[model samples]
Target: MTTNTRAWRWGQLLALTLGALSSLHCVELPTKSYSCSSAEDCQGLSGPGGVSYVCGSGGWCEAPAGSACPQASTPPTCSTSNWCWDNPLSEGRNLITVRGRSATDIWAVGERGIALHWDGTCWARILPGNSQQLRAAWPAAGQTWWFAGAGGSLLTWDGANWTSQALAEQVTFHDIEGASGTSAIAVGQAGALYTFNGQQWRPQSWDAGTSPAPDLLAVWPVSNTEAWAVGRNGTVVRGVDGGWSRVSNPTSVDLVAIAPGADAGTAYAVGRGVLATYANSTWTASSFATSTTPLNGVWTSAGVTRIVGPASNIFVLGSATPEPSGTSQVLNSIWGNDTSLWAVGGSGSIVRRAGGQWSEFPGGVARTINAIWGTDDRNLWAVGDQDLIMRRVDERWSPAAPPEPGAFRALWGSGDTLLAAENNPTATGGSNGKIHLFQNGQWTPSASFPSNGVNAFWGTGLAPVWAVGTGGLIRRRDEAGTWLTEGNPNTASAQFNAVWGVPNAEVWAVGAGGAIFRRDVSGSWVSQRPSGATELFGVWGTGSRDVWAVGLNGSAWRYDGTTWTQVSTGVTQTLRAIAGRSTDSVWAVGDNGTITYWNGSTWMPQVSGVSENLRAVWVTQTSVWVAGANGTVLRLPL
Candidate 1:
């Protein structure tokens, strides 16, 4: 690899689009300008992805190190803020449940006390400082809101402060709802049911003579006296006048969420492979032909029914039109009436539907980054979760058009041909494995893969890439563009995480149980375990005789063409990915922001400045990039 001659600047990394990131009203940027007369005029100015601006000679705020650049060889001194965020424009936190009075006033809550408020125009992040995984929220219009979650966490937001109330510490509330500040209801595990009536909290008996009281998962409140709760084994109950009675359900699958329909006596409920409708006090059920993933939320208004579930899937009844949700993450909860709709899901995904179409809110592409790859400083690819293929071309990051619906795991490019391993969860039972090819700006599905999910890709920068994934399945794509399985075609009980090739030599794959497998000349697999670690996440090598592997608990090992020996790295954080520029320089990154380097001698630790787990790392001549959870990317100039 050759070093990039152009001077790279921090000004380009500062092009952060601050759409809905900060919770503090002060740090939140206002409507800004795009032109500038001097560098001082561009100060404190930024765009999407939080990328800051610099004054160019054209009297406009320009990115990418400004118009007049410095020589890459003559770099400036490093700043304290080395690692920074580059995508989603904010700290992307998973939002599980959303509630409020209307579109203008909204509260979307997630685990670990993460919440956000939408005031029609802007979204502000709110971290309540509670580490417990929150499961439910009842945003009661005004300042007063209710929250309950794991460990029986029950707290109230009274505009100015959050107040916790005593409750069973072992029970986890899964869902909560309230009519106003005075009335609300929450249902949870182990048939857990609680009621709030403005003054004191009370535990209500919800069995009404059912066995073990099926763990209630969802609750809907019509009035203080009338409420409905649903749970496992298709259990549904109606409470009136302080008495709970069991109701008939059409399916045995667990009902996760329910919503009243447009009609007075109509309702819609969805869950695992089950969709049911209730009208005139009778229940009927069916399943989606195109989806088997559990449906999480349902909404109905003005005779229109909409359902949201895994894979950012959204569809409306009557029309049954599959709307592009702009995300591939699973949607956990959806809200709104007919014209305006909001669906929040995994990894900070927020999408809205209006004017008979769906548009994104810019938080979905930052889902857990699994892998990062690029051939040059001008081109890089990051792929993960629900069809996310973000490309950084010419120093700008944008998403490529997604291929067939699936969760992308690994990405590699050879010349103009880009290959991505996609876990197609649209299948019935589990994910079906497939490889997608990106050429000429479009993604096309390749032949079917043997495993259920592909994890990593490694090979020469040419045809015949080696792919390894779940089920201990190994496959290779030859020059003819045909995928041929190399290992046992039916042996699928184990999972492989990473793979590497030795040019014209053997291929190596590492996975759980410290499994190190090498393909011989005859294509036979030989397993070796020099370091009896529990799990190995990544593997790479400099040559046929010189190879390295990193895995659980900071485990590292090197092969001398004969055997593997364990090497100590001095840290216990699990290393996920390993990449090297040569035998003299290598980098490994993993959990808790751990970044270690091998200087052809001893292993040394480097400061990452963030605690978010780093999953993927890429080494180039000028810079090293690390990607991980919460849309974090740290850059260290080499």
Candidate 2:
């Protein structure tokens, strides 16, 4: 036999004995040089399993069908940030229940009647019927689903259409389940229980005429003769051998939700961080140490427990398995001083950053604080719903007495004096537009606005504050207690929303439809024409020689004392507010969490990494602060 053939036979025998060897193993090899321009030209290089070699250009052996090989000297490549996945936006607060067949196929509903689906990778938000929270979901045959929630809300999804159904009683429907297409039960607040028999939903006959309101939270069905319902004040009702009986819970706190765990016969109920296991006709309570921080949701899947709270706090409980972690800043409102910083948002979230590290502050209020402002590092104020006004007196924040129950739109402060403009809730048959001033340790109501609603306000000091609102209302205070109307800016159909002032003489008012009015040294307002008709919302100036204005539809303009010139912002998002430490160092913020910088001649976009609507920007020599809806606040290094 030839030497090559003998070597091939021995190699084949070796490979056969080593069963671990894969089919790609070669039996024989002979070295020979071949020339080729393309893959098809390398004929003799084919191996037994279609493995072949090709030669091209510089004549190096390579895989028959592949791109050029990498250089041997090339180093490995990597990226800095993960840049792969980010936190999912919270569609609603107070998620009461979540259920899914798989990791990606899940549904969650909560306060504001919000419903969303998790399709394994990301969440796709769905519009549930009402703004009231949906508490439970029951999936039936043929893609039919039923949802129950606040105020007796019942909706059915038949794979295509979602229609609301009226219940017989006016109560909050909390839990629902079914054993078959014709047999279903629903229970809710006020000891309400309903039964459905294929054709219609009707009240279930019960003899507990003197039973207190149940406030039911969940329901489960084991079979035609066995079911359970759990609810408030630690109440549980069980169906035993075709009969119903009441049971007592160890804890008096409300049992918010319940579900069967790994063993279908075993069930669990969760309430106030306490979990109870029910199995084999007995119940045992266990304590789950959740954060002192207020929690909004608790969800379980595949033996894992996930909890979410304010400030983007998502925690996975259960012996530390691999899960998503970290606090993503869902900033709502932000304020900064020369030495300290603060921000607040959803779920009474409060964060403070000092010397470059952020920590959660425990003394935050419960409402969503919408506006934040301060005179200095020692004192600050945040305002929001439920008549909220929190004050930072020294290093800690305490809830202050809120002003009248109205939505606070704009806040401006100088020294210890402050002025807040509220959107008139009475105008459209709501509250009348009014201004509240904080001076001498008291919040006093001031002159009412001429227009129906206030939009924005800006000023240098306490007395000469300027506030603008709807219907082109301009209220000015010049060292006087009264707010008087200045000359109506002749922008025809535009409604002014913002006013910026270097002083009484050099004030600029901006609003919708690209209207900008400049007040010269005589307090006379003159309209500045822009190249395009886009609404302007914010204006800032380093001096009288240079000023910049930013607004909707990606509009930004600069005025150099003589003429106004359009500047390219490199973005189409609406710009809402502007602040600058110098003419060449200006920052503008707006809708979609946009931040644009002016570097002497060109405007460039910076990565703010947020999607909330930024309404205001404030800058100092060392830092910049941006504030927006959802209590979003972001600060970047100067």
Give the best candidate by TM-score: 1
Whole-model lDDT, model 1: 0.69
lDDT tens readout by residue for model 2, 101-189: 33434555555665655443223346654577677766665566788888776887675567899876878887777777556778887
Error of 2 at 487 (Å): 1.4
User: What stretches of model 2 exceed 4 Å from their correct place?
Assistant: 1-256, 259-372, 375-399, 426-431, 489-493
Q: What TM-scores do the predictions have? A: 0.59, 0.48
| lDDT (CA) per prediction | 0.69, 0.57
lDDT of 1 by residue, 40-135 (tens): 877876544355667665455545563121111112113253544444422445677877666677767775566666666445554456777677
Question: How far does residue 603 in candidate 2 sit from its true spot (Å)?
Answer: 1.4
